[model samples]
Target chain A: MKTVKVGLGTCGISAGGEKVYKAFQDELKENPNAFVLKETGCIGMCYSEVLIEIKNGSDESVFYSEVTPDRVGEIVEKAILSDDTIEEWLAVKPDNKQNFIDNQTRIVLRNCGIIDPGSIDEYIERGGYEGAKKALTTMTSEDVIDDVIKSGLKGRGGGGFPTGVKWNFTRGAKGDKKYIICNADEGDPGAFMDRSILEGDPNAVLEGMIIAGYAIGSDAAYIYCRAEYPKAIARLRQAIAQAKKKNFLGDNIFGTNFTFNIKIKEGAGALVCGEETALIASIEGKRGMPKFRPPFPAISGLWEKPTNINNVETFANVPWIILNGGDAYAAYGTEDSKGTKVFAMAGKV
Target chain B: MSQQQSDNFKPFNVDLWKYDGQEGALIPLLQSAQDTYGYISEKAIDYISHITGIPAADIYGVVTFYAQFRTKPLGKYVVKVCNGTACHVNGAKPIGDTITDELNIDYDETSDDGKFSLLSVACIGCCSLAPVILINDETYGRLTSPKLRKILRQYKRKVKEEK
Candidate 1:
C-alpha cells in the first residue's frame, strides 16, 4: 500500500494538524483504492509544522511543509496520484538527502512515526512485540534484567534513574502482587514528547510495560495519564482493549504462564503529580502531593506492594532493546546519557 | 466536586455586593465570568456577584490584581510586549515605546478603532532571543524598534489591502 505520513506531533497538532488529519481522513474515504493516510510523531523539523511525507511504489518519497485542511485535496491529487509534485510546499527531497533522518537518532522513537498507534498488527509488522516474545521464550528473567543493565538506558523523565537498577530492585523486593506503572503524567512546561508518543504509537509503550511486568513478575500495570490529553487517553484506552483482544495483555500471553493486565487512571491537574510518590498518592485517590522518598516505590508502593514507575519515553525504549540486542541499542547516545532522548523541542525550535 | 459545580446558579446576572463576603471565591468567580465572555463586561461583573454572593467593589479590586484578567474589551490583536528581566535588559523598553507612540495609547489600552490592544507580559520564556513581543500566540523575537515598526507596518498593510 502507498504510504503518506503526517506529522501529528504536538507542534503540528497545536498548529491545526488535528483538523488537517480529519480533512485527509474524510478525503481519503472517497478515494480509498489509491491511498493510505498515516499519522506519525514529530520528526523534529517543528518550524515547518503539519509536515507530510508521501511515498508511492515507483516514485521517490517527498516531504511537504505547512500542510492545512484546505491543501489536503491538492496533496492527495498531486503527490499521491499524478507525478506532478508541488514544489512550493515540499520541505525536503527524500531521495537526494534524508537531512531530517540523518541528523538525529531514532532508538526510543523508532516505531513512532512508522506504525499505526491504535493497530497491534502494524506494531508487530514493525517488530513491536518481538522484545516481549524474546523475553518470554528465549531470555530468562535474569537475562532480561542483565540486558537492560548493560544497555545503560536512564529514565528520560528528568529523574535519570537507571531503568535496570529499578527493575532489579523490584525483582529482588518481596511481593505477591507487584505492579509496573507507566507515568504518562507529562506536566513539564513546553513538554509534550510523552503525549505525542502515547498518541502516535501507544502499543510500543504497552509492550515495554508488559516486558517490565514479565521481568519483575508482576501481573498488573497502571498507566497514569493526565486528563488534559483527551486524545492520547482515548488512543491508549483503545490500544489497551486491542492488546487484550489479541491475547498480548490478558492470561497466558503468547502461550506462556506470564499473564498481565493494564488499566488507565486519569490524573487530576497537578504539576507535582509527575513525581512518582505523588503519582502513587493520586492513584490511591488522595490529594495529589509529593511525599519524602526514602522507602521508594520499588520497596513499598501503590497498595503497599513493589511497583516500578517508568515514564512514557523510557518505556518506549524497552521493546527496541529487547528486539535489537542491548549492545545495539546502547551504541546511540553519549556515555552519561545513553540511548536517544525524545524532547518536545517546543517554543523556539 | 464542590457546591460551585452545581447548576443551580443563574447563567448570568451576578450581584457585585455579595462578592466581598467570601475570601477566595472572588478571583475564581471573575475568572469563570471572564472565560464565559472573552472580556469581563459590566454584565459579567453583575453575574459574578449574583452567583458568588460577593460585593462588586471587592470584585473589581480583585480583577485589577492579576495582569491576565482584563475588565475592558480587548482589541482583535493583543500585542503583549515582554517586560521580564531579560526582555527589559535587551531593549524591550524601546519596542514598548514604539508601540505606544504608533498606537497613541498607553499599556493596557485598546486602540479606538478596535484593531490593536497593548499589554506588558512577565516573560514568554524565549529569553535566548530576547526583546520579544507575542502578537496573539505568535512570538516575534530578537526585535529591535525598527523591526517592530516594520512588523506593525506589515499588519497595517494587510489591513489596508483587506479594506
Candidate 2:
C-alpha cells in the first residue's frame, strides 16, 4: 500500500507542517482507504519544510515542497490517487539533493528521513536493536568497548573525546552502580542536529544507549533532553515504551541476564547543563552549574556513581558501527575522524 | 515528556513531590512558575520556594541567571526577533526596527494594552532560514519588512477578533 509521510519535525512544524498534516487528515477522511497518512521528522531540509513525500506502489517516491493547507486537495488528487505529477509543487527530487545526500557518508542519519519515528516496528524492521542484541548476547563488555575503540568514534558533543576510551574508564571504575547518559541537552543557538536525531531516529539512540549500558556494566541510563523539544520527547516516550514491551529495554533482554532501562530528564532551561558535570547535577535536581572536575564524570558522575556521558549524535552512530563491524565504520572520514559528521551545511563549502 | 505535563503548571503551587526533593528540580520549578503565571511572580516564587525549600533569594538568583526566565509579566504575544549572525547579515536590523516601530515598543517591553511584547533573542537555531521572527512558537522565516508588517496586522486582527 502507498503511504504519505509529512515532515512533522520541529522545523517542519514551525514551517506550517501541522497545518499541512491537518489538511491531509481532512482530505484523507474522504478517501481514507486510498492511502496511509504518516508523519516523519525533519530530513535536514529545514529550508523546505512542510514537505510531503508520496511513496507510490511502485516503490518510487516523490517529494513535494512549500505545501500549504490550501494545496492539500490538489496534491491528494494529482499526486497520491491518480499518480499524476504536480511538477510545480514538487520540491525537486532525491536526484536533485544527490550532492547534499551523496556527498557525505550518512551513518548517523542513515534512517533519519526514511523511517516513521513514531513506529517501533518500522525502526525494528530497519535493523534497530541488532546492535544491542549483538552486544548483550554475544560480545563481552571488553570486546564491545574494544570494537568501539577500533571504530575510532569520538564524542560528537563538541568535546571530541574518543567514545570507547570514555566507556572503558567507566567500565573499569570501582562502582557497582553505573549510569549512561544521552546528553540531549543541546542548547546551542543554531544547532538542531541533536533535536533532529532524537526526533528522526530515537530508537537508534536508544539502541546506542543499550549497547553503551552493556559495555560499561550499566543497567540504567538517563536521557537529559531539551524540554523545548516536546515533540522529540513525546516520540522518545513512545519509542521507549515500544522498546520495553519488546523486551529490548527491561530485564533479561533477548532472554539474557543483562537488564537495562532508560529514563528521560527534562532540561527546563540551562545552557550550562550541556556540560557533563552540570548535567549530572541537574539530574540530581539542583542548579545546572558546572562543577570543578578531576574525578570527572567517568569516575564520579551522576549520583556520584561511575557515569558515562555521550552526546545525542555520538550515540546515534553506535548502532551502525556495531552492525557493520568497526572496520566498516572506520572506512569513512579522515585518519583524524572515522565517520561522517553532520552540519546544517550553510555557506559555500 | 508529555505536552500535557505543561498543563499541570497552573499557579506554581501543585504537589511539590513531582518536583521537590528531586535533584535538579529548581530550574524546572522556576520554569514552571514562569509558565504558570506568565512571568515568575513574587508570590509564585515564594510559593515555589515554600514547596521546593530552595529559599526565595536563591530562587530569585536562579531566575536572574537564565535568559529564558522573565521576572515581569509578558504580553499575550511575545515577538522574538532573531539577531544571530545569520539573521544579522541577512538584513534583520531593518526588520527588527520595523517590528519595534510598528508595535511602539522597544525590545523586552510590552505594548500599552499588553497585547504584544517584543524580545530580541539570539539565534533560535533556524539559521538556515535566516532573518527569522518568531511570534510565540510560530516562526516567520526569511522575513522582509513587508512580510513582518503583514503578519503583525494579522496578529492584530486576531487580537481584535478575540476582544
Candidate 3:
C-alpha cells in the first residue's frame, strides 16, 4: 500500500497537471487494489511542473519533475512497480536535503494538500478545532486575547498590523454588536497564497474566525472574498455549511454561551477593495473606495459597529497559536515578523 | 406596426450593423473578442456593446488603457519591443528606433505594406536578460542593434521565402 502523490497546487494546474491527474485516474482504474494515488499542494519547486512523489515499502520517497499525461503510464509501471528511479526527472532528492520545509514552518498552511479540503472529519483528524474546544472549555476570552498579545503575531496581510492589537481595539470599543471580517480579497497580481489556503483548507480559516469572534466578543462575521476566486468561494461556502452542521459554527458553539454567525460577501473585481477601509465600505454595499481612517475599523466599522478585520492567512494562524500555545508558535520567523509567511513565488524567481 | 413603418426602420437597423458592440466590452473581454475575430472593427464594437449593455465610449476607454488591446488590425508579424524599466535602462530606445527605422512605422502602428507591427511593453520580467525583444512571444534577450537588425533580416527573408 505505497502512496504515490502528485502536486496539484495552482502552479501545477497552470502547467497542465490536471491532464496528468486524469491520466493517473485512468491508469489506477485498470488496477484498483495495486497502489494508493494521492494529491498534494505545491512543494515550491514551481520551475518543475507536474511534480510526482513516489514511495514504496523499503525505499525512501523520490520526486519526479515535468510529469505529463504521456508519462503517467511509464511512471506507474517503471517507477511504482520497478526498482529503478528515473534520473532525468528527479528534481531534488529530499531524503536528507530539506530544501523546501527546512527554513520554512507550516502553521497556517499545516493541513494544506495533506487532507481533503471538502471534509470536516479530515480537518478534525488533523487537529483542526482543538483550539476552539480548548478555549470554550478552559480559557476565558481575556486569556485568549492575552496569549495572542504575547505571541506578537502580526497580520500576514500587507499592512503588517499586530493581530492582538486589532483584537484589543475591537474589545475596547463600546458596542454590543461587533463584526469580524476575513479579507480574502487577494488582488495582488501574482499573489494566490490566500486563495490557496481558502481552497485547500477552508476549515482552518473558519475555525480561526470563530475563535476571533469569541476573543473579540463579536456575534457576526463576514468573509469578504473576491468575485474572481469562484473556486475558493464555493469551497468556503460548502465548508461553512459543513461546520454549521457539525456544531462548529452558528448558535452556542460547542455548547458554550458564545453564539456567532458568518456570511460571505463577494467583491465586484475592484483592486482597491483589498484595502481594509475600502473592503469594509464594499461589504456595506458602498462604492469600493478608501475612506479616511480616524476611528479605524475596530472602532467604527461594518455598519458603524465595532469590527475586527484580518486577512485569510492571519486568521488561519489563530487556531494554531491557541492550540500549540503562543510561545511555541511565536518561536518561528523573524523577531518583528512572527510566524511563517506564505508567498505566491511568482515571476522568474 | 404597419409595412410602411417597418420599411422606414430598416435603414436604421442597417446603420446599427456598422457598429459592433466590442467598444463596450472591458479590456480583457475586448481582447478575447479580438482574438476570436482576427481584428476588432466597428462591427465588433457594436456587437460587444449590444451583448454587454455597456456604452461604446466606456469600452474604448478600457481598450486604450491596456497596452495589449489594439484597435486596428495587426500586421502579418507582431514585434513587441520591451521598453520596460530594465530594457529601457539597458538601451531599448535604440532597438525601438531601429525597429521603427526598419519597418518605417511608429509604435502601435502597422507598416504600410501590412508586413509588421511595432509595439512596446512595460516589462516582460526578464530583467536579468535586459534589452529583450519578443517576436510573437519567442523571447530574444541580450540584444544589440546589429543583432536585432540581423534577426529582422532573417524574419524578413523567411517571410519572403514563404511567399
Candidate 4:
C-alpha cells in the first residue's frame, strides 16, 4: 500500500495546507483503503509549502511542491492511483530543487518532513531514543560528557561556546539539585530552524534533553520555548506526554538510578529572554532583563541551583553525537568548528 | 464604562488556579488575559496583580515592556506587517504603507470603527515568502502593494456584507 503525506508545518499551513489536506480527504474518502494519509513538518522549503509526498514500500519517495486543493485531484489520479510521475510538480527531480537537501548535511533535520512528528513510534523507528538509552544504561555520566567533548560539539545558538565544557562545569558544580534547560527561545528574525526541529522531530529534542540530564547529573529540565511557536509547543507537549507513558522520561528512565523530568516554560514574547540569564529570570517569573555573567548559569542559576543551558539546536545534536560517537561528528567540519550549521537564509536575493 | 463596554468584559476563567501561587506565573497569566480579552485592560491588570501579589505598577511595566502585550483594544482583524531584514529588503515598508493608507490609520493604531489594527512585527518566520503580512492567523505572502490593496478591499467588503 502507498501512503500520502502532507506538509503541515506553520509555513505549510500558512500556504493553505489545511485546505489541500481537506481536499485530499474528500477525494480519498470514497476509497478509504486506497492510500494512508499522514502529516509531516517543514522540509526547510518555506518557499514551496503545501508539499505532498507519495511513498511505496522501498521505492524512492516523490514530492510535489506548491500543491493546492484544486491540484489534489491530479496528484491523486496520476501519482497514487496510476503510480506515475509528474515532472513539473516534482520538487526533488534532477536539475531542480534536488540540491537543496543534497548539498547539506541534515543531522538535526533528518526526521523532519520525513516522519510523522505526532507519532512517537515513527520517531523511535528512526533510532530516536537510542542515545539516551546508551547514556543512561551503558556509559557513565563522565563518559557521556567525554564523548561529547571528543565530538567537539559547540552550541549552535550563534554564541559558538563549547558545549562539552559547559556540561562539564555544570556536572562539576557542587549543588544538591541540578537543572538542564533547553533554550528554545529562538527570537532571531529569519531563524525558523529551532521551530522546525521542535515541530518536526520533538522526540529527538526530548531524547537529547534526557541525555544531557544524565550527563550533567541533573534530574529536572525545562524547555523555554517562545509563545510565537504554538505548534512547536503543542508538539513538545504531546511528545513529553508520549515519552512519560513509555518511561523515556520521568522517574528512573531505562531502569537506571537516574530520574529526569522535563517541563515547558513558554516565553511571553520577550526577545531579551533569548539570553541565558534573561531566560532564567523569565522562568523565575521576573522581568526578562540581562544580568551579569560571572555566575554564568553553570554555577549559580535558575532559582540559585546549578544549571546547564543549551540551545535547541545544541540539544538536537546530542543524541546523534551519543549514538555515532564524537569522532564521527568531528569528521564533518573544520578542526575548530565540527559538524554542519543550519542557517536561516532570507532577503532580497 | 458604558453598559456595552461592561457587557463585553468576560472574566478570564481558563486555568486561573494553575497560576495562583506559582512563581514566574505573571507573564503567563498576562498572556492568558491578552489571549482572552484581545488587550490587557487596567481592570484585568488589577485583578491579576491582586491574584498574583504583583504590584500593579510592576504588572503595567511588564505589559509595556513586551511588544506582544497591548493596553488598547485591538480591531476585529489584527494586521501584522513583517519588518524583518528579509521583509525589509523585499519592500516590506511599501506594503506597510499601503495598509496604513488604505485603513486610514498609522502603525499600532486601530481604525475608529474597530475593524482593523495595523502592527509591524519583526518576522513571521516565513522569510522564504518575503514581504508577508499576517491577518490574525492567516498569512498572505509574496505580496505586492496592489495585491495587498486588493486583499484589504476583500476584508472591507466582508465587513460591508455583514452590515
iRMS values for every prediction = 9.5, 2.7, 9.2, 1.6
Winner on lDDT (2 vs 3): 2
Q: List model 1's recovered fraction of native interface contacts, to 2 decimals.
A: 0.00
**Of 2 and 4, which scores higher on lDDT?**
4
lDDT scores of the candidates, listed in order: 0.76, 0.83, 0.75, 0.87
- Please report the candidate that would top lDDT against the real structure: 4
* TM-score, ranked from best to worst: 4, 2, 1, 3
Of candidates 4 and 3, the better by DockQ:
4
On residues A1-349, what C-alpha lDDT tens digit does candidate 2 reach at each position? 6789998887788778899999989987787787899889887777877788899888888888889899988998888778688887778753475645446568898888888899999998988898888888889988888889999999999999999999999999999999999999876656788888898999999999999999999999999987767778998999999999999999999999999999988776667888999888878766677999888999999889999999999999998888888899889889999887877643222
Model 3 agreement with the true structure over B17-121: per-residue lDDT tens digits? 333443211433454555554355666666666766777775565455433455667777789887766677788899999988876889988776667888876
TM-score of 2: 0.90
lDDT of 2 at A73: 89
Error of 1 at A19 (Å): 3.4
Estimate how well candidate 4 is docked, as a DockQ score: 0.60
lDDT of 1 by residue, B60-158 (tens): 654554444676667667788977666687788899999998777789887776778898866444444467787866667668888889988887777
Write one digit per residue (lDDT tens) for candidate 4, span A117-181: 99999999989899999999999999999999998899999889899999999999999999999
Candidate 2 accuracy as lDDT: 0.83
Which candidate number would show the highest TM-score if scored against the true structure? 4
**TM-score (0 to 1) for chain A, all models?**
0.93, 0.96, 0.92, 0.97
lDDT of 4 at A292: 97
